[model samples]
Target chain A: MTFDWQYIVDALPHYKTALWLTVKLATIGIILAIIVGMVCSIIQYFKVKVLSQIVQVYLEVARNTPLLIQLFFLYYGLPKIGITLSGELCGIIGLTFLGGSYMAEAFRAGMEAVTKSQIETGKAIGLSNLQLMRYVIIPQAFSYSVPGFGANCIFLLKETSVFSGIAILELTNTTKNLMGIFYKTNEALLMLVIGYLIILLPLTLFLTWLERRVRHAEFGN
Target chain B: MLNSGISVLFEGVNMQRLLLGLLVTLRVALIAVVISIVMGILIGIIRTSKNKLVQIPFRLYLELFRIIPILVWLFVIYYVIPANFDLNLSAEVVALIVFSLWGTAEMSDIVRGSIISLPKHQAESSKALGLSVAQMYRYVLIPQATKRSIPPMINLITRMIKTTALLTMIGVVEVIKVGQQIIEVNNLDHPTISFWIYGFVFLLYFVICFPLSRFSRRLERKWAT
Candidate 1:
């Protein structure tokens, strides 16, 4: 078989729209994940004993299980319990919870990396725990943790495709629909691959740049 | 109705199907792990190579693989490649190829990081002992790197196994797919069986993954001490 340039051209317009959906899903999902992750990390850091253990278990279950099952649980299971959300909302919620768990771990690792002496010095200056964390601990931790956070963000961006299974009309779902519609399986799937790369490549590059900047800042040179 | 669900799980024929599905999952994961480890080691070496050109491409390849979701890659490989190239491969083959590509990229990064994190003096001292590059790597460098690499490598293996669930989308009858089939069969009369069937699938994955998870942590502790 030979490459069909005409097929690719014909599919390009459809792929453009799918690429937009993919970008929207990833961007919104990641922003939500970062916010949820920060909140969960803060709670995990400061909450009392039993609450901490509950948060820890939540993180473990979220991380250990497959995202597909979790998506199914939210999209299909929640309605059974008298709580219903749109498929898109369910997808975003699932991605946020899953992504947040990993991001929380990254934040925790970052917090742990803050030197004891530095925290002690902040306290010696008569800073309360909250002030010490807000002023001294968190800023330093964020710089050191940027690479891990960036990596998790990129992972979340890709993982948003799992939303396709729940009929979210994202890139993968669109590709599958187009394939069934046109029966031009090859062209449709090729456009899907291109669609994913179009969205992911730039984000990957940006994250790499961000990681480098953070590393440079951390090392002071 | 509940009895039938339990019997479907334990009936000789159905039990065989579940066991066969389990074996297929294990087989795919085991083969993928072996292939990935070998490719990972080679790419890891290339990534840390003194040659700038080689290192740059390897780095790009690693990042691309890591950034692309496994499900998307599975779709691209199992559906796109065969259709694009007109190569008629089985779904299992496609799944293996895609998973190995992804796993190798991850493992290579892990290997590269662990190797680089080693003290520079270790390599320098080996060179001072008049060892050739090949001897230095073979005798001095790799043994230490292998120990450092085991925990992450095991974690990667568990990940690959869990990831096999995605193969069901491409029509490979793994355990999750088997569960879906059971649900479909019982849907007409007992729609609630969907939960039990899927719940069983979850337990199956947990059984397979939890041990590997424990083993990974154990190896991590052992290596640390």
Candidate 2:
């Protein structure tokens, strides 16, 4: 089958809508992940009481199971317990939950990697715990974890495709839809791959740049 | 009691279907794991080679696979390839190819990273001793790298099993799909059954993957020290 541009052109409006939905979903998911991740990682780093153990369990469960199963649980299982969520909302929850677990690990690593003396010096200066974290700990930790966060973002973008299973008409779902309408998998699939490449390719490049910059800054390169 | 999802799961036919579906998932994961290991090593070698020509294409292959989601790759393997050629394969077999394609690229990068991260002195010393390229890798480089590769490889295996869930999306009737089928067949009669059945699927995946994930973490800690 020859490559078909006409179908791609015809499907652009729908595809554009789908692309925007995907970007919106992923952005929201990533932002939520950053919040959840920061809290979980800080708890672990500080060795907080029962809360840290709870965070550990959450990380294990979230990391081990497939995103598909998590989506199924939120989309199908939650309704049984007297809660209901739209498919897009379920998608966001699953993405954030999984992405958060991974991000928490990054933040934990970054937090621990900060020089012990730096923290001690902040305390010597009479900085309160919260102030220390705000001025010193979080800034360095986040910068050190820049590459980790970038990887999580790329993973999140791909994970958004699975949201299609829950009836979210994101990019992958849009491709499936276009294929059904046009009866040509070639065109739809091609456009889908290119669409992903367009976003992911550049994202990967920028992430590498950020990673290098972070490492350089850290090492005084 | 007899109307519950557990009761439905205990029905002989349903039990057999779920078990069979689990087997399919395991089969896919095992085959993909083996293919990824062997193919990944070869790609890793090329990736670390001094030749730019060899490096660029493999790097592209690696990145392309990395960027695309496994499900999208599965769709392309299952639908687009068959349409382009005179090839007709079972959906399950197509699923395996997709997993291997995804896994090989992933595993290769892991291997390449470990190799490149090694001190250059090891290879230089081996060269000074007149060790052949093959001999150097077989004895010195690979032996050290393999240890580093294991924790990541285990992580990759867990990921492999997890992605098998996506096969359900492509009509493979894997474990998750079987659970969905049961839910669909029972939804009208037993509204609560979907919850139990799907929850069981989640548990099954946890049982299969969690141990592997734990082991990988343990390995990571041990290796770090």
Candidate 3:
């Protein structure tokens, strides 16, 4: 029952792949969420009829539901409809859809934070709505959202661990597999905790720094 | 809109089975929330304290809980504790511990935020009125903080309820786990049954969570104005 390093040493290589897969899942998932978020927020911002209502419903359903159920629905339920996806693929998609909803809220807040005065001035200067959005509104709105984007990315990283529930062999899954073989559940889990801590601790720190830097740059501090 | 799933709930499945699973989830979440609020308030008070030693441990706790996903926490609590310490705990008990631990950390943050956001003069006036520190907190501070805290607290409720779904991963036989079991037992290699059963699970969660979330949002908007 004592903590043993031997099991971890023996299992390190497999764990590395799991860690990499976790990273890849989170990276691709956040990227897709950002894309989804930007599009949805833009549509909602313009008060686009019908589409805005759809966006509202999508955001609410996603925000309310647990991500594990969403993953199960995609992983287990979707195949019922004649579509089969690998666990990793389904997990990444689930994370993308879940994180996309939160990311949309952030972007919407950022866009609304752009004062009416700024838009009016842009319009007053003979800028077309298209030119204004491209040159002024979107850039400023994005800068306002850098902090939100950072938070959303960190959240997406955490959410990717849910992939293990669907058997994606991520860090937690790798640990469980090692435990199955080595019968060193505690040691294996300690190593897994450390692995995630190592990855996430520095990430939280870096996001904090990045947020500060973004805020300073925005305020010209 | 989701009534279609309700028929699947009772059509080929034991209604009591799903309800029992759902009861387990609700029982765990309810107990965990009560524990969290109590522990959270105490920790929140310490978090605002002047002593560094008092604050550092809670700070570490918060940071650790923030990164470690609930699924990992559930696994570690359910499996790691028993294996390491030679203590046997049931699934529901372990789930309760993990959820309460995580919830306390989060709720404390909420408490700290609400209290800190109060005007400096409010606390000052309480002190100037000859109120002791306890009185200042109990009579003057908690009321205002509670009002400001309602929105975030509601958000945490929805989060706590949703997190109970992760209990399925650890084999808790909670609602989602029950849904999975039903799908497996009923379908017998027919995937389409899962479409209805899992769809019901989704709608069940949506029904429980949507109203709370909208209420939280409304509170947020109301307070913002």
Candidate 4:
């Protein structure tokens, strides 16, 4: 059970590929999630007819369920209905499905934080409905939502770990595969944790800085 | 076709097994939640101490849990520690330990947030009324903070429940694992059995979590007014 560095060195190339795949999947998933979130939030904000109820149901189901089961349903269950998704596609879709609802909640909270007086001010100034939303609501909402968006980004990235369950060769899967091959559980896992720290720590620090920047700009600190 | 897919749950002892597995999930989550709440309160109170030594370590602990995925923590505790320390623990034990550790970090943050968010005048008035420090906290702060923290804590409980699904990865016989077992046995006859089984597992979680989340939201709304 003594520590071994050579196993990590041996597994470095596989780790590299796995890291790339994880990054690629997470990036595409997050972009799509933001798009989904924006549309859902807009529907909710405007109280669009039937779509708001559909979004509510979508949010509840997505938020309550774990990504692993969702992946199982998508990867294993969907084939029963004649829809087959590749492992990578399943990973992306599951991530987007999960993340979109969370992002929608964040965006909705942001929109809700906009004051009624601000909207009235915009209306009183002869701004049309579209112009009011464009000029008054969106910017303030985006600024207020920065912290929530940052947290969701981190959450979505961490969730990509479950993509391994669907057979994607991501970081966790690569670590387990190496452990099985080399019997170097300690080294492989150490690298796995460190690899994630390497990826996440900088983003966290940057987000904290960005959050502070937004806060100061908002409050005149 | 729909009848055949639905028949998997009615098979021999399958429904019972899934319920037993679900009980195990709730058991693990409940135990972890209780332990985390008690320990988190203590840690949260300690964290408010103005000592850099105490605060720095707790900050590190929180960030460690926040930055890393729980799955990795599961593997580390389940595999690495037992091998290194010559200690053998069951999968359930490992799951409990990892989840409590994660939950404590989260709960402590919640506690810390609520404590700090109290108005400065509340503390000032309590002190001005000749209340001792302990008396002030016990009588004035703790009660208010606990009430403020309940909604978020309930939300955390729902999160912990959902997170227990990760236990299946470590081979814990939780609900999802039970669902997988059912699918394995029935896939030959009903190739669509997974859709039904996983769908049920999904609903099982939603049924448990939705009400809890709704309650939390209700409390949040009530308290806001």
Candidate 5:
């Protein structure tokens, strides 16, 4: 079958709206993930007793299962227990739940790379525990984790495509609906791939550039 | 007791069907992982070459797979190709192709990184011993890189296994689909059946993946020293 540009043209408005929702959801999800991740990493880093154990369980549960099942659980499963969430909320929560574990691992890696000598030196200088964290550890840990954060951001954004599973009319869902309606599978799928590339390609390029810049800044090229 | 949510999963052949679905899921992942490992080693070795033409195309391939979500790739391959081409592939075949291709891209990069990160002396010493390039790779590079690549490759297998859940969207009768079917069949009598069914599905995945991840972590730690 010949490819039809007209169907794509007609579907442009839907794609635009879908793209906006995807971006908004992904942004909110990533920001929340950073917050959740930071807390978990800090708890684990400091070796908090019961809380660290909880975070460990959360990490394994989040990391091992697929986001699709997580979304299904949140959207379809939770209501039985008298807790109901909107589709968008389910998408955001699922993204955060998965992204948080990954982001925490990234942060943990960065934090662990901070040598014991540096901590000893900070203590020798009479820096308090809080001060050591604020002035000594956080900055270096964050800088070291710059590439990880960039990678996680791109990952979370690409994950937004799965948001459609929760009945969010994001790009994938919109494209699927159009294909079903018009029976124009080629046009719809083309637009769907292009729609994702349009969103993710530039973000990937920007992140790679940022990562390089951060590396150069950290260690003199 | 029979009307309870948990009972819904056990009613009739539902549990058996879910197990069958799990088999499909594992089948896809296992086949894809095998294909990915073999192809990934070849591509990984080639990727270490100093040829720009080869490098650029593989880089694009890697980026394309990285940036695009697998579900979108699933759609394009499952729907787009069949619509345009004369050939028709089953959903299982499509899932295999997409996962294998994605796995290969990821696996090759891991292999390439391991190979590139080898100490300079290993290559120099091998050359000094008058080993040909192919012999050097066969004896020196591949063996060492295999050790480094194993943990990440195990991680990749877990990822592919997790990713096989997306096949449900393509109408593959995977675990999620089977659970959904059971949930639908039991919906009239049991409204809360989804929670148990989906929970069971989650546990199924965990049972398979958790040990694998633990093993990978152990390997990483053991091999690091």
Candidate 6:
């Protein structure tokens, strides 16, 4: 079969709109995930027994299952329970919860990597537990957490594509719609692949650069 | 309503359907894991090659796979590749190919990391003893890297399995799809089956993934000690 460059050229405008939507969802979802993840990680770290256990269970369920199910559960399952959110809202919420669970793990791992001696040193200087955490523990923990957190964010960005299943009109949804309209599955998909590469490559590079900068600063001479 | 939902989970046909779904889930995961391992080793080796031509292509391949989402890749293969290439492959075949490509990038990174993490002196000693490069890797370097890689690889396998749920979106008839179909059919009579069916699906995935998570931790501890 002959190749058609014009089809892809014509599809650029549609892909651009989808790309904007994908980036918006991913950014909003990631911001929400970071806030929720920080809260969950702090709850676990303090070890408030019952609440921590509840948080643990929630995280496990979210982490182990697929995001597709979680999205469907919210989109379709919730309407039965008298809770109706739009498909886009459901997609964002689903991604946030899933991303938050993984981010909590990242936060916990970072917090654990902070040496006890550092906290003790803070205490020796008469800093209270809250003061120490606010000033010493959290700062160091966040630095150590950056690499893993960045990786998780990249993963989350990629995962937002699944939102298309519920008809969220993101990048993947746009490609699917175009394919349906034009019946040029190949050209539409090819454009989608290129669109994703354009968006993701710079993000990945930035995260990698941030990771390297953090490592260097942490171990500076 | 809650009690009725609970009973449907235990009923015969629903149970049978869930079990079959679980089996297919495991099969897809197992096949993907095997494919990833083989591809990982090959790409990992190619990545470390001294040849600039070989290394550049392999590095580009890894980046492309890593940056793109698996779902997008799945869609490309399922809807785009066949039509583009004029090939008429089955959905399952497409899923496998897409997963393998994604897994290969991840596995290669793991392989490269573990191999480099080994003590430099070990390789130096092997070379000093006249071991060829291939022999050094085959007999000396690989065994240690494989052990280090296994735990993360197992974790990645669980990820691959959970991700198979995305195949349902493409009409793959996998476990999650089966649950969706059941919910659609039972919408009128068993309105609450949706929650229980998905809850059951969640539990099934947990049962499969939790052991791998535990095993990875245990291996990590053992290796550390």
Q: Estimate the lDDT of model 4.
A: 0.90
lDDT assessment of candidate 1? 0.78
Order by TM-score, highest first: 4, 5, 2, 3, 6, 1
The C-alpha RMSD of each candidate to the native structure, in angstroms, is 2.8, 1.7, 2.4, 1.4, 1.6, 2.1
Residue runs of model 2 more than 4 Å from their true location after superposition: A216-221, B1-3
Query: Against the hidden true structure, what lDDT does model 5 obtain?
Result: 0.90
| Deviation from truth (RMSD, Å), model 4 | 1.4
Off by over 4 Å in 6: A1-10, A219-221, B10-12
Model 3, residue pairs in steric clash: none
Native-referenced TM-scores of chain A, all candidate models: 0.92, 0.95, 0.95, 0.95, 0.95, 0.95
Tens digits of per-residue lDDT for model 3, B118-183: 989999999899999999999989988988888988889899998898887788888887877777
True lDDT of residue A141, candidate 1: 81
lDDT of 5 by residue, B1-225 (tens): 324999878778889999999999999999999999999988988999989999999999998899889999999899877777877999999999999999999999999999999998999999999999999999998899888999999998998999899999999998999899899988778888988999999999999999999999999999995
Cα distance off (Å), candidate 2, residue B171:
0.8
TM-score of 2: 0.96
TM-score of 3: 0.95
Error of 4 at B37 (Å): 0.7
Q: Score the docking of each candidate (DockQ).
A: 0.36, 0.71, 0.68, 0.81, 0.73, 0.63
- Could you tell which candidate, 3 or 5, scores higher by DockQ? 5
Q: Candidate 3 — which residues are off by over 4 angstroms? A: A219-221, B1-8
- Per-model interface RMSD values are 2.6, 1.8, 2.3, 1.0, 1.8, 1.6
Model 3 whole-model lDDT (C-alpha atoms):
0.85
Cα lDDT tens digits for candidate 4, B29-53: 9999999999999899888787999
Fnat measured on candidate 6: 0.62
Cα lDDT, model 3, residue B159: 90
Candidate 1 lDDT, tens digit per residue, A1-221? 34567877877777787777778777787888777777677778787678778887777666666777677666664554456789888888888888888888788888878888888899899999889989988888888788888888777877877787787888888888877787777677667767777777887789889888777666323
